[model samples]
Target: MELLSLDKLAARMTPGSLIAIPADYSGVSMAATRALVASGVRGLRIICVPTSGIQADVLIGAGCLAELETSAVTLGELGLAPRFTAAAKAGSLTIRDTTCPAVHAALQASEKGIPFIPLRGLIGTDILRQRADWKLAENPFADGADPIVYLPAIKPDVALFHATKADRDGNVWIGRRRELATMAHAAVRSLVTVEEIVDVSLLADETLAAGVLPGLYVEAVAEAPRGAWPLGLQDLYPTDDAELARYAEAARTEAGFRAWLDRFLDGRSAAA
Candidate 1:
């Protein structure tokens, strides 16, 4: 895997690409998201593995997204993601409302190289009705009329996230966050940002190997310390609660969002 600059890494993400991103609690590449906004790339279709937060909102507010498929987009205790809520109401973004189970099933289908995966959780939900692509089928093996929702495979063009570290061999250490590995496996390729890079081989250690996403699926890597800032790396740092609160307030209006974004682009650190 090639080690690249953050901007150069963002440059590799072309317009109209389908990208899979993990939830806020997982490793989120906010640094790369900022670079993506700065580059002014457009027509991105995001697949939030299950849910999203400011990362998706920032892209939506910047008009970089063409479509978004997710269960929800909220700023946790801060409440609804302002930009996402605004875009949805204005009908500026195409939203494909899905559930956590459905999204995981779809990606798992891709991972298994299958056309579609069946899910029972969505069988009686409005999400099933709204998704035209999701089909309803009767179980042939069942004794009675048992119905299920068929979620089509979602093979994203790229999977992006941040991590605590990468070893010389490019194996990313994700701890117990196996969903990130699932994302990389389901996507065509993966781009990663890390806090640090060490000379040791992560895979050589049996304990470390269990939590590592092997470099085979990684297309590129970039060193970006505090890459998940405002957000947080698991156990490395805490989420910047003050910054998130500020963003939640500022992003409520167009002018306020633009001003906040300007400061962000200028590399002015947020008061945390």
Candidate 2:
């Protein structure tokens, strides 16, 4: 398979495409997302993680775009700040209560060209109750009382990933995490932004190479270092409480929010 270039990746990736972003909080990923927002595109489906959730608040508070919050938060909890309670009041944003596994299941269902698939274990839990979207019906084939989850096809139109390293051809080693491969198999298109683009042979040291999202799955790749800044560098980039607090205060009022957005969310941090 041929490797991809960043230009090719950007050209094919536009707004209105569903995406399952990595939970990793790479500064570069945020920049890429901000760029997408600036392009006037909408509709984003983020794979929930603590960091991704925070970034969502930043983007949402800035009024850059809108989203269906599906991670840890709930529908009624929309008004309840991320820093606050369990349930939202009525509506701030629609919550699509599916967890990250739903991300894999959806993509897998789509890739296989099936209408839906039964999830092995995610049943009879809070996820089921919180997710008003989940369809409930008797198992057509089974005689027992256990119900099945008919997860629909979830191939994101395009996917973006930041890898620890990549080759000029776009083959990457994205750490030990396996989300990228799951996303690639499920999506029609994929893009990878890596810290460096080097020779594919240099990838021998990666113990998790089997989990690598192959070059064929990648539609485009860019050599972008320090991309995971505000987000992280693996174990690095711990949560910045100050930034989050400032954001809550800034978004408390519309005028203050606008100013805060222009000053910081315009791509800079609270200190920047």
Candidate 3:
């Protein structure tokens, strides 16, 4: 894997690229997200594995996205993601509404190099009806008129996230976050930001190897200390609820969001 500066890593993503991002509780590369925003990359299409929070909101607020496919987008305790809500209300964003399981099934299908995967849920839900790509088919194995949903594979151009650490050999330890592995496997390339890099080989240790995503899947890595700031990295830091609250409040208005974005880009906000 190539080691790169954070800005350079962000630069690798081109306009209108399809990117897969994990949920907030997972390893979110907030630092890299900031760099991407600063780089002024636009017309991105984001696929939140299941759901997302501040990371997706920040990108949408910055006018970097043209389409979004996800199960949901919320700021958790901080309330609705103001910018996302505003964009959705104004019909400025193309939204592909999906269910949590459907998102996972689509990625899994791509990981296996399959064209589509059968899902049992969403039989009577509006999510199934709205998704033109998802087709309804009768279960051939079933005795009667049982129907199933077939979700087309969703192969992203890039999978981006943060991790606790990586080894010199470029293997990233995601601990129990297996979804990150799924994303890397399904995407064409993966970009990672880590809190640190160690000299030892992560795959050499049997225990560590179990939680590691091999370097084969990683295209690049950047050393970004506290890379998951304001969103928290498991066992390293807590989510900056205060900062999230401030963002939620400030983003309620378009001008307020612009002002907040200025502080964010200028590195004058909390934890900057």
Candidate 4:
């Protein structure tokens, strides 16, 4: 397995990649989102449930990519807006997967290197028919019930995440409610942003391990301090609402976003 330092991970991601981000309203993966936006990537489809993680909110605030809302609204309803009503009017698409299980199912098909997976419990539902992106079918394992929707696999060029501690080799200890591992499994390649890289010895102890994101699957690691905000640390830190307000204010206006970028996000501060 190849091990890349922060610089390497920062270097590999470019503007052309399509990405998957945490679909929750908390522990928002800011580094991963910012890095992709900085590169000029085409678009990103964030996952969101009714009111959690608002990952979509922060992303939209940044003027980065179009949004993919998995709520009650259809893609047509959202109008392809990332953070803007105008962008959506420009033709953004939305689907009503509405649950993590369904979302993961689609990604699983991609991770397994298959074209599509047969799922159940969504047949004749609004999500299956109205959302052209999703292909719904019956589950072979079940006899009679709602059919399943084939969620697509996500092959991100890079996976940037914040960890409590990971070793230099890339074995990750992502505690609390983690969607990173689930994402890492489906991505084509990945990266980790850690608060600390611990000794290789500690990784073996089971108590320190609720879940481990194996290093072999990761190509790079970035040592980031205060990396996840508006998104909390597993147990150490809480989401910073003030910081979020700062971001929201900046993104509310184009002039504000550009000015904020020049002062904070564009140069040395961005990398920090």
Task: For candidate 1, give the lDDT of residue 113.
Answer: 98
Q: Candidate 4: global Cα-lDDT?
A: 0.56
Query: lDDT of all the models against the reference?
Result: 0.92, 0.57, 0.92, 0.56
**Model 2: per-residue Cα lDDT over 1-272, one tens digit each:** 34444444555554455665656343236555555545544544444421254445544554333344355532121243442121133355445666666766776777688877777666777877776656656578787876777676776766676767766555667655666676677777777777667775434656646645677777777665655544565654454556656655655555765666575436677667
- Lowest lDDT sum, 10 consecutive residues, model 1, at 263-272
Against the true structure, candidate 2 reaches a TM-score of 0.73
Candidate number with the higher lDDT (1 or 2): 1
What are the per-residue Cα lDDT tens digits for candidate 3 across 1-272?
A: 99999999999888889999999999999888989999999989999988999899999999899899999999998889999999999999999999888889899999999999999878888988898999999888998899898899999999999999999878999999999999999999999999999999999999999999999999999999988867899899999888888889989998888888888776667435
Candidate 4 on 1-272: residue-level lDDT in tens?
34455455655655344455553332445555556456555455554422233345444545555445455221222223224443445454332345556666666776788877666576667656676777766566676765556766555555556677778667877665456776677777777777777767435878765577777677777766666654677676886655445545554556665654554444233224
- What are the TM-scores, per candidate, against the unseen true structure? 0.98, 0.73, 0.97, 0.73
What TM-score does prediction 3 earn?
Answer: 0.97
Q: Is candidate 2 or candidate 4 better by lDDT?
A: 2
Specify the poorest-scoring 10-residue window by lDDT in model 4: 72-81
Regions of candidate 3 where Cα sits further than 4 Å from its true position: 270-272
Shift in Å, residue 105, candidate 2: 2.7
* Candidates sorted by lDDT, best first: 1, 3, 2, 4
RMSD of every candidate to native, in Å, equals 1.1, 4.9, 1.2, 5.3
Q: Give the alpha carbon lDDT tens digit for every residue of 1-272 in model 1.
A: 88999999999888889999999999999989999999999999999989999999999999899999999999999999999999999999999999898888899999999999888877777888898998999787899999877789999999999999998677999999999999999999999999999889999899999999999999999999999988988999999898889999999999989988888776665442
